[model samples]
Target: MPQKKLPRLRGMDNVREDEELEQFGDSASLFVRDAININFTSAGRAELRQEMKLATDQALRCLWQSPLHKDCFAALGSYWCKVDAETWQIEQLIECGPGDVFHIVLNNMICMACDEGLFVYDGSQAKRLTIDTPAKPNATDAGDGSLPASDYSLAISWVANGLESALSEIDQVSLSKNSSINLQFPMCLDPNVSHVRVYMTEPGGGELQQAIELNIATRSVMIANLPELGRAAQFQYLSPMKTGNFLREWRGRLWAVRSNVLYFSEAMSYHLTDERYNFIQFPQRIRFIEPVDGGIWVGLADHVAFLRGQDVRSMSIERKASRAPMYGSSTLLHSDMIKELSQGGTWCAVWLAENGFVSGTAEGQLVELQYKSIKGISAESCQLVGFADRLVSVVN
Candidate 1:
């Protein structure tokens, strides 16, 4: 056949797939899987490099900026250390076990939960919180136990006896004038027999006396007319049957979650009393609870929820519909994954999901960043930390 002039191909822009592809350039931001390095002035995508190195042999568990020391604290396998000017300074704050999990920060201290018990650590020292519990009655003793437990009054007394055994002591509990104290039990307490006893020490080495106007309830106690300035006040109440796994401070209150129940401490006080605290139950097992934006983001076993102003709303990514109480994708998130669940900015928070990464804004918008180039990145294996303008994620 006679030779015909062929049209010249300007560039390989239309080649979507190529086996022999080499150099590529585009004005749009490109996501890639492989790592590369280009000229600093060139607008090309490149793999992230390690900006700073941590000096430690043990695996790093968590990192946070300490407001007191004005440095970063790294929680390694068995101990924690302070990182300043890129130098890892080991600190013997607390001996953490395998199951130990750092909970939250309050009053310039960090709270940790471990198999032994709950512990609090300042920059210099660590103290294990004493869990006050009343003596358990002997089950075999049958004086009142032999009587029929059917009469209403007798039933009430029996309940009181049971509560006496379950009483938990509140240590170092203090209150201000006209303020209330909230107590959180490990489990719900019986309102019939549960009551709070507040012991206040008078000024100048005076005797300790119980305060009045106590409002007792199932899980909390409220005491009004607290002395303005007493030597100190202590509280005791029925012990909680269970201890919470996580603790955080939000909206002027201390929050703790055990299983599906959420407990709130009295406003502006850390004391959890039967009359002072409130609770909310969820349908599914709670995986994580964090304060995001001005509200709280609750990650359930299958989905996520948002609580704001006494109202709770479920979030899903499937529903693109606007004007809903919560706005987000309906993608199923991995509940067990606990990495980078914190605020990314003033308006948004970042967290890991089953498939990829996600971010939720204060306006109730959830976004998924699942670029194919970064598909191999596992959120579960990464520890995320936020800085002024960037987020640093360390992968295992």
Candidate 2:
């Protein structure tokens, strides 16, 4: 057979395959590479001329920036190393055991949840906050009324006909104070009592009434815009249900979640108790919860919910009746996969979805970023971290 003359290829467009034409379609500034490292410029452009390489061969599991130490922490394999922000040098901090998860940072303390226990690191030392075995409280003696009270105590007494009755003990108490008071209790307290009563007392006349306006929890109580009660304010220790798996501080309150239940402590309180905190149940397991804008964003197995209210006591499952469902059957990978970044002046939460990636705003807006380049990549193999002006995603 005679050879037929073929047209000379002039450019990529002339020789492009059907898939390449569909993916790159008429775009001049688009580029794709199997492995390419690029730097983001101050002018908001990706400078692809320079390439970089990883210092280690281990897979990167998680990445976090510590404002206290001015460095970045990277969890690779079973080891956590600190990357110096100025020199970009990596220093191994500790070798974590299997199933160890780094939770959050509060008060310059790094919190981690592991199979062993809850650990907190204060820059230099790591200590586990032990959840002691709950002790059983003995029945009150009928005659003597002598019970060794906890390090904290709360009592109430009634006065009638100018006669004062003996004070009766209560589990929880809320008091009004003009100044900020720190309520401290033993880390290990009996977990039997569930509810505590708070009383607002008039300092001058010794008049007391049940405090309905004050926010009190098992670990702390916050009283605002009220006069000092001197020595009249008191509280007794009480045990609440077991703590949840995930903990985060949001809107002046501590939020904990386990399975499908979400619990929030009282305003400005860190104590997690049934009486001091309220819980909302969701249809699916809550995978992530984080503070966004001025409220909270909860990521469930199949949906996302936003919570913003003045009082945590009033938050219920009914408030989440309008949750936005995820695309198809996609779900979040892990709680730590969610990252909140500032886009323009508003805050946006980005997470790794089972399909690709998704972003949501505090205003109940969700956008799925299923770019053609990342469409079919396994979600578990993708890790995302937000820097000052850019989002870096690594695929293994």
Candidate 3:
């Protein structure tokens, strides 16, 4: 005896019989499964595959119809859809609403809004919206209650894109896994705030890392550590001068140089392993640091140096020369005043400053950089993450 097949739904009693969809005429019958696996005969196997296909198609339609999904679909072209665990069988396609997608985890899924505004949403409800301004808000505008009254933004990272590709199963965006929710910001120029904050939390909204705060009144400098939430972190007070400067993490060290005073903490550990109460005592203000020859590259006013283990030495003795590419004699006047540096490719990248930008390679080769004309806009605040192919930055 042949196995029985599931019945197909009719499309308003089709007058043309040939136009009707076949439930079993083509390949096989279908069955749907949630998570559990079921053993079935060859006939059942065919049905399961068909059922999976139908489920996936229906889910995609729901995702596509969503207003939230359509708004910035291009920037989020990397976005993918999956069946909602609780509403898998719901026939109506999922529409983008308050709760369609909210969180983005590395290599997991990323939820983004179409417009350049703040979107507040609960799991299923959107609470409020605020549009972003073109220019940095002035001090007077900062006092106005235009921005959301959220303190967490001070220590957060503003990722414009590439967020959806960062999530992973170890930290997925489901209800059960150790998931975390981060509000995304494209730029950080709010007059009210000094700097953005970055924190890591657990599925239940518990903090996993402590908060890192940057100073907005200063240059583009930041500590590269995601605070360890819940842990009581202690720091040996090495009174770093409050020169209104910034701290940066490189090669696993919290590095801060104030008026020639070089202060360094162990990488990730944040422990004051070594401190030269005065950095100017060594040479010039350590301009920048990089990774070279399996060691750390330290840039000074006129030389490129290296540090490995505990030994620091100058690799190039060309003092008074800029470590970065120079377009003219004036760009080198402030070799220590590097505004921005980004990896361009496996071998090249561009730099930025108030005057203009330059380019460089991993092998210490540098060149003045230029951007191919895009509309009437010029690239600024540009940073290269992977190689030269994927440039992530915004233009003024």
Candidate 2: tens digits of C-alpha lDDT, residues 248-303: 66676566676788876544434324444367777887766756663566777556
TM-score to true structure, per model: 0.52, 0.52, 0.25
Model 2 pairs in collision: 153-235, 154-235, 172-196, 172-197, 173-197, 173-198, 174-198, 191-239
Query: Between the candidate structures 1 and 2, which one is better when assessed by TM-score?
Result: 2
Better of 2 and 3 by lDDT: 2
Model 1 Cα displacement at 253 (Å)? 2.6
- What global local distance difference test value does model 3 have? 0.31
Clashes of 1: 22
Tens-digit lDDT track of model 1 for 166-276: 233323332222233333323424333444333433322244444331334443333232344333233334233223655666766666677788776544434333433
Candidate 1 vs. true structure, TM-score: 0.52
Compared with the true structure, all predictions reach lDDT values of 0.44, 0.46, 0.31
Name the weakest run of 10 consecutive residues (lDDT summed) in model 3: 161-170
Best by the lDDT measure: 2
RMSD of 1: 13.5
lDDT of 1 at 205: 29
